[model samples]
Target: MRLRKVMLVFKKDWLEIKRNHEVILPMIIIPLILSIGFPLVFIVGITMVPESASSMEDLENMIRNLPEHERNALSQMTPLQASIYLFTLYFLAPLFLIIPVMVSSVIAADSFAGEKERKTIEALLATPISDSELLLGKVMVSFVPSFMITVISFIAYSILVNILSFTMLGRFLFPNLLWIMLIFCLSPAMAFASICLTVIISAKVKGFREAQQISGMLLLPIIALMLGQIAGIIMLGPVIIGVLTLSIILIDYAVLSLSVRAFKREEILQKLI
Candidate 1:
C-alpha cells in the first residue's frame, strides 16, 4: 500500500469535508440533541419530581407486578428513588447505542454520496489508489469520526450524569457495568456496522437524503431495546449488555464481509439500479 498516496487521498477529502458545512453540521447537531440534551432533561426532571406523589404510587403498583426475581433486583434502592431512577434510566440506556449508530450512518452516507453530489465522485475514482485502497480510505473517514464522536459524547455524558447524580441524587449513579459494555464494545461495533453499510449505500445512492433515510434503519435494534425496557419486558444490565455486544459483533462480522465482497468499482461505476 502507498501510505503517501492514501494520505494524499485522505487529505484532499478532509479539506473537502471542511468546506462542506452544509453536509457536516447536521451530523453534529443531531448528536447534540440525542446525547446531551435528552440526558440533561431526563436527569434533572426526574430528580425534581416529588418522590411520594401519585406518579410514584402508580410506579409502585407496576413494580409490584414485576416478577419477584426482577423486583429483588431493585432492592438496592428506595421505592421512591427506584421509581424515578432505575425506571427512567432503563429506558434512556438504549439512546446511547442508537445515537452513535445514527452518527456513523450520517458520516458514511456523506462521505460517498456527498462526493457524488459535489460531482467529485468520478474524479476521486480517477486517483492512483486501487479500488480496495480507495474503499479503505472512505471507510477510514467514516469510521474514525463515528468512533471518535462516540468517545467524546460518552465523556460529555459521563460528566453530565455525574453532575446530575451529585446535584440531584446527592451521589454518583452513572457508569456501571452496563454502561461499560455499551460504551466500549456494543457501541463501537454498531458504529462500524453502520459505517460499512452506509458506505455501500452511499456509493450506490445519488442523494444524501436517500442514503441517510435508508441508513436510519440501523437504529431499529436500539429503538426496540428502548421500547422493551419501557414496557418492563427487559432490563438493561451488564449481563444483557454483554449478550447484546456479542450478538452485534457476530452480525457485524457477517455484514462487514458482505461489504468487502460487494465493493466492486466496476459495479459502483455502472451504478446499482
Candidate 2:
C-alpha cells in the first residue's frame, strides 16, 4: 500500500515538475554556469595568462613553476607532497559541488510552499496517504533527483577541471582523493541536508517565493566555505571531510525525522485558506 501510494505521488509530482519551467531552468542553469561554463572560462583565462616557463600566478604566488625537467623529477616526491598539490588543484571544483547542493535546497524548500501558493495543499492533504507517507514521498521526489544530478555534475566538473588543468599545467592537477571524497561523499550529505531542512522551511512558509528567499539565506555558509577554500584558509583533507560528511548526513536524518513529525495534514489543510 505504502509503495503504491509513494509511486503514485511521485508520478504526480514528476509531472508537475515537468510543467514548471522555473524549477527546471534553475536546475539546468545552475550546473551549466557553476559546473561547466565557469570552470571552462576560468581555465581558459588561466591558460591565457602568460606564465613563464617556471612561474605559477596563484597562492601568494606559490604555484610550483619548476623547470619542465625539474617538474618531471618532482614526480618521485613523497606522497604527502603530491597530495598537497592535488588538494590545491581540487579547490577549483568546489563551486560544482556547492552550486548543486544549494540548488537542490532551493527546490526542496519550494515543494511544499509552492503547493500552498498554487492553492493545491488542501487537495494534497485530502489524499488518502498518511502525512508521514506524503512527506517521505515528497522528500524522495526532491532529494533523489537533486542528489543524482549533483553526482553527475561533479563527474562532469571533474572531467572539465582535469582537462582544463592539464591543458594549462600540462598535468592532471584537480580531482585528487580528497576532492573525490568531498565531491562524491560529502556533497550528497550536504545536498540532502539542505533539501530536508529547506523542505521543513517550505512547509511552514506561505508562498514559494517567500520560501525560496528564506531558503536562499541558508546558502551563506556554502558561499563562505567556497570563499574560504579559494582563499586557502580551510583545507579539507580526507579525515576531516569524512567527519564533515558524517555530520551532515546525521543532520539530514534528524531533519527528515522532524519534517515527518511536524508534517501534519491538519496544518496543511488549516493553511489552505
> RMSD (Cα, Å) of candidate 1?
3.4
| Candidate 1 global CA lDDT score | 0.71
Off by over 4 Å in 1: 1-9, 48-80
Q: Write the per-residue lDDT of candidate 1 for residues 1-273, one digit (tens) a residue.
A: 666665666677667676778646866876788778876675566557655323534555446545575467556656546654554355566777876777777667887788777777777777667766776677767776767777777777777767765764687756766677888888888787777888888878877888899998878877887777766567777777788789878888887788877877667656733
Position 240, candidate 2: lDDT: 66
Regions of candidate 2 where Cα sits further than 4 Å from its true position? 51-88, 169-175
- Clashing pairs in model 2? none
Candidate 2: C-alpha lDDT: 0.68
Model 2: lowest-lDDT 10 consecutive positions: 52-61
**Best-performing candidate as measured by TM-score:** 1
Worst 10 residues of 1 by lDDT: 52-61
Residue 123 Cα positional deviation in candidate 1, in Å, after optimal superposition: 1.8
Q: TM-score for model 2?
A: 0.82
